[model samples]
Target chain A: MTDTTVKEPVQFFVTEDPHHHDGDHGEHHHETGTMLGFWIYLMSDCLIFGILFAVYAVLGGNYAAGPAPVDLFELDMILVSTFMLLFSSITYGFAVLRMDRNDLKGTLLWLVITGGFGVAFLYLEVLEFSHLIHLGATPQASAFLSSFFFLVGTHGMHVLGGSIWLVVLLIQLSQRGLTHENKRRVMCLSLFWHFLDLIWIGVFSLVYLTGVLL
Target chain B: MSDHAKGGHGSLKSYLIGFVLSVILTVIPFWVVMGEPLDNKGVAVAIIFILGGAQMLVHIHYFLHVTIKAEQGWQAMSMGLTILLLVIVLSGSIWVMFNLEENMMPAHEQIERVRNLP
Candidate 1:
């Protein structure tokens, strides 16, 4: 070999396991990363709800010449709404199960049912709020009403958002089929749906049920 | 395969269990409040709160799949931190507010008596 080109040792990056795909298994789909990010988001969401709850607790008993919880809260109405949401959460679980099984049609069917229940829940809440407002118990009526409206209204908004997400997801599921990315989206939405249900539990217990009791 | 190995993600059995428990917990409190099963308001409040707490655990465990095992304990860690913050925020707010109300707001009867005196 001609020694005319005496070159310095070439510097380049090297690795013993450069081609190892062990860590890059199914995780390349960004499933774990998205899940962790979503979880952090949910925790922050929890803080928001927590503060709202604290506000409700603080201002709950402040009638200020306005309607009290017992006067405004209808046990029957809230009970029905509670079941609507609880059922929706379970239906969402069914949808996720269908996703796990790669049954796109079944998933959509269950998601529709879940959305139906969500709509029913929001309807009941809207009706309750409207009835209260008609009876001169608007949020502007008193501190108690203000906190009640804000806390429950925030939760209702979340459900509305989830319902809209459900419609969009149904569209996505139809167009894209049950791809890995779609499945991850389903799981994330499922987490969100159930998280809302958890917060509702606190609301009904602390705000409504306990409110009437107190 | 990983999904299959990890328990509580989408199990039908767990969902059913959670649903049933949630319904019972909800119904019992409603009954206690509506029917006034116990004459004591405090007892009814205590029962409702306890059952409510249990039902929340059920939802967290089964529906949300928040177990000690999920995500290599990340779920539990985050959940624990959230619970701690919630307790602090909720209890602190309630305590401060209750004290504020006591110190600031007069009872209706006291107000009425003051009105008559003036």
Candidate 2:
């Protein structure tokens, strides 16, 4: 019995050390946790967007004789803005690739380009909104306009928040040079940026393209 | 450290593939709408929705890097649950509201009959 006990402790010692080392070296504990947490947050954000989409879907037909979607939505300009967002999504992907390679300068450059595209998207959106208001299709004009503005405006606000986060991350990256915390931040922001692009797919498809078609 | 870290992110080739697919997907819908090649509006709208959903899956795969293996499958699990809930919320609200509108709102003739009840 004593011999078996001694051998068992020896076996446990051998297995425990490698297992501990593997856990420490293979991945950072907090990094995985942070990523999972951020992902959960994004899923919750998705629910909010789902609600807004429902609101728009239900109320989109009540134009109150003010103006229909085709009359207000300029497909040409919207297509341009859609390209801006798609380009930004790719550029942000490039940035994440650069980060993976530890290419600091390349990552920053791609991020800057991504930011430029994001700004262009926002500018186009603001132009569209102002033009709509000028044309007297204000939110108060009809339930359709109200829901349209709310859904699309909420998406724009998310993009705006992401842009701000990107700027902050850029500054942090420049100062810290991709430390562990900065790397995690970059990864989270990457998720946010890409998620926004995903949401844009819905917006352009359902709100803009279908709106015009309807 | 970098090697293991790189596992989670996509390579340049993958990103390029996704970008190209996305561009094609996006362009087709815009073209269909602007060019009006499809005479049937319903068919055109269906095409737009299908392509848009395809593009969204592409983004989720390529950009988000979500997989059954990611985060020991927790990511995929959470995403699945969220999608289920999203579908329920969106479809439920539309269905209920549409039914409510249909049943509750009186027809013009019915309203006139009620007014003439005196």
Q: Which candidate is the best by TM-score?
A: 2
Model 2 residue A78 CA deviation in Å: 1.0
Return model 2's CA RMSD, one decimal: 7.9
Task: Tell me how many residue pairs clash in candidate 1.
Answer: 0
Q: Which candidate is the best by DockQ?
A: 2
lDDT, candidate 1, residue B40?
A: 90
| Residue pairs with backbone overlap in model 2 | none
Candidate 2 chain B — worst ten consecutive residues by lDDT sum?
Answer: B1-10
The lDDT leader among the candidates is: 2
Query: Runs in model 2 with CA error above 4 Å?
Result: A1-27, B1-4, B108-118
Give a tens-digit lDDT track for model 1, residues A1-214.
0110121122132422232234544342234556767887999899999999999888887799878998889999999999999999999989988776778889999999999999999999999988998999998899899999999999999999999999999998898676545666788898999999999989999888899998
Listed in order, each prediction's TM-score against the native is 0.87, 0.88
